[model samples]
Target: MATKNVLIVLSSHDLLGSTGRPTGWYLPEFAHPYYVLAPHVKLTIASPKGGHAPLDPGSVEAFKADPESVEFVQTKSALWENTEKLSTFLGRAKEFDAIFYPGGHGPMYDLATDPDSIALIREFWEAGKIVSTVCHGAAALTHATLSDGSYLVADTPVTGFANAEEDAIDFSQYMPFMLETELNKISGGKYEKAAEDWASHVVVAKEDRLLTGQNPGSARDLAVVILEKLNA
Candidate 1:
């Protein structure tokens, strides 16, 4: 079988809302997935403006004990240092077999409403390609709609950083909008979450090829699912 091409979109927004704290893509959310899929697929990393996608320092500190996350920072792989521009692939969704978003609070600020990102996602869904996200990465799906103008998640089983999870982290007030609230508003009862906060929860609407993970803990699991879908 031919190799699959996956586009990993990271956030360019680095500010953590009005708190004046720093935030970007979460370290493990991207690192764990990259390692799981890299050897088997072709991956391209991109950001809104191309170059130096920021990392959420808090995540780095929190997951510092994690070897993969540490290696990603200590080694400074070419992936995050020099990401291609997200807009550069706007009209080329067909060139990829899938698109993945690994989250941080930053995406809630930018990727959630980025026009180029939304268009690219729509193109992928319309092309019947896999659309995947983990944690707040699901923010990228908040504004995407179908060709008929209905929400893409309106009838799909989806999961994201839940309100409970957001509250547990105490970063809810610093958010532009609650990730769970927005996802629930548009999901039309299709949004799901684990019984408790921070638990691993992943949902895959196989028929639609829409896959989502509840939080950072679900990152590796989500990537494994992406691989399953890619190789199915």
Candidate 2:
């Protein structure tokens, strides 16, 4: 069988706090999936804003402490150093077998509302390609519309960065909106979550080719499920 081609979207935002601390894609979100999928498939990295993707400082620290993540992080090809801009990729969504959105607070700020990103997602969904996102990356689904002009997630059970997890991370106060609540309001579908910590993850729905991960912890698990679908 041919190798599956997957697109991993990262975050371009560089600022983290009111003090202007540096922040980018959460390290584990990218590192974990890249390790699990790259050995078996061809992976390409891109972002909504494209160009040099940013790395969240905290996630970087976490990666440094773990040898496997450190190894993945050092691999130049996997680092999202340069990427196709979302606008350019939007017109070529069919080239990929699946698209994975790796989460960071940055995605919440950009991916959620970008028209191009929304259309890209709808394009993949309509083509019956696998679509998955973890943590705040799930926010991107907010703007995806179905053929009936309704929200794509309107009836699909899904999950994202829960309010409790946000609170634990102390980022809830700074966020413009809560992902879990917003997804619930838009979907009207049951939204479930794991415990308060980020180590737990759950894939709440899978119908046809659509899949979603609850939080950063679910990143690899989500990728594994996507791999199963692509291989099948």
Candidate 3:
């Protein structure tokens, strides 16, 4: 059987915390999905501007010290290379069956506003493909629209990086607006969260073709749902 192609969306920002403390993409968000999906699918990583996507140092540090994390890291070596540019991926996204976005502050700054991302999402969903986003990565969803000219997430029971999670890390002030509030305001959807931190994740919506994760920790579960929906 031909391997199914999965597009992995990553953040382009390489900054630390809002305090310039050096933050990058959450490592677990990348590792969990990569490991979970590798055995059954071919994966390609993408970023808005392409090149090297940054990893949150804090996330990377934890991955370095933990044995289980390190084991997963060694198993998924494809992530260490530079990802494809978002523009290029968007142009050809239809060839894939699944598209996923990992969480990190970088997405809030770029994907949330990138026209290419919005178009890619619109195309993916309209084509009946499985779409997934975790943590702040759901910021990309804020820009997606439906075939009826409505926000794709409007009225969808989805979750992402929440206000409480931001507050816990003291990064709320740096965010232009909380993701949950912004998603609710734009789509008028009933947003939900598992708990205070990004560690707690949930897959709130799983209709025909959409799968969204609340935070980093949810990435593994999110991939499972995506693979199931695709194979089903």
Candidate 4:
């Protein structure tokens, strides 16, 4: 069998909805999955503009205790230093077996509306490859349309950072749009969540072609699910 290759797309946007606060891809969301997937598959990191992608400072602080997060920061791998531009990877989706998007407020700002990101996702889905996202990374699916002009996530069971979770952080107001609300409205899918905020929750839909994690806590579990699918 050939080696599995995964494309990891990180948000390049660094602003937190005009709040004057800096935000980028969350540390654990990328670090956890990277550590889990790296040994098993070849991984490539990409972003909207390529080069260094910003890191969410709060995420770094919050996940500092995690070993993977610690190694990710201490090593400063080239994977994070020099991401390829998303545009360059478009139309080459078949080269990869799967694609993963890590979340942060940054994705809500950029990847959600990036034409290249949207097209790449649609291509991956159309090709029956695994497409997964965690937390606000799910925003990338917001505008993805199938060949039939229907939203790719429409009528699919999915989960993302819930509105209540956003409210709990008191950061809901700063967001350009609520993730859960947009997902519920746009996907017309059965969107549910864990009873408690920050708990791990994952939903696999579209016959495993679409997988989503509810929040940051779900990152590792989501990676495990991806590994299972890849090995299956």
Best by lDDT: 1
Candidate 4 residue-wise lDDT, 80-105, digit = tens: 77999889998998999999999988
Q: Could you give the C-alpha RMSD of every candidate to the true structure, in order shown?
A: 1.0, 1.8, 2.3, 1.0
**TM-score of the candidate numbered 2?**
0.92
TM-score (C-alpha, index-matched) for candidate 4: 0.97
- TM-score (all chains, Cα) for each model: 0.97, 0.92, 0.89, 0.97
- Which tens-of-lDDT digit does each residue in 25-70 have in candidate 2? 7877777777788889998888867778887878878668777667
Per-model CA lDDT versus the true structure: 0.92, 0.79, 0.78, 0.90
User: Model 4: which ten-residue window has the lowest total lDDT?
Assistant: 185-194
Per-residue accuracy of model 1 over 1-232 as CA lDDT, tens digit each? 8999999999999999877899999999999998899999999999998999999999999998999999978885688989999999988999999999999998999999999999999999999899999999999999998788988898677899999888888889898899888888898777899998888999988485899999999999999999999999
The better-scoring model by TM-score among 3 and 4 is 4
lDDT, model 1, position 15: 92
lDDT of 2: 0.79
What digit string (tens of lDDT, one per residue) describes model 3 on residues 28-54? 887887777888998888887777777
Residue-level error in angstroms, candidate 1, position 10: 0.1
Q: How far is candidate 2 from the true structure (C-alpha RMSD, Å)?
A: 1.8
* After superposition, candidate 1 runs with Cα above 4 Å error: 206-208
Q: Looking at model 1, report the run of 10 residues with the lowest lDDT sum.
A: 72-81
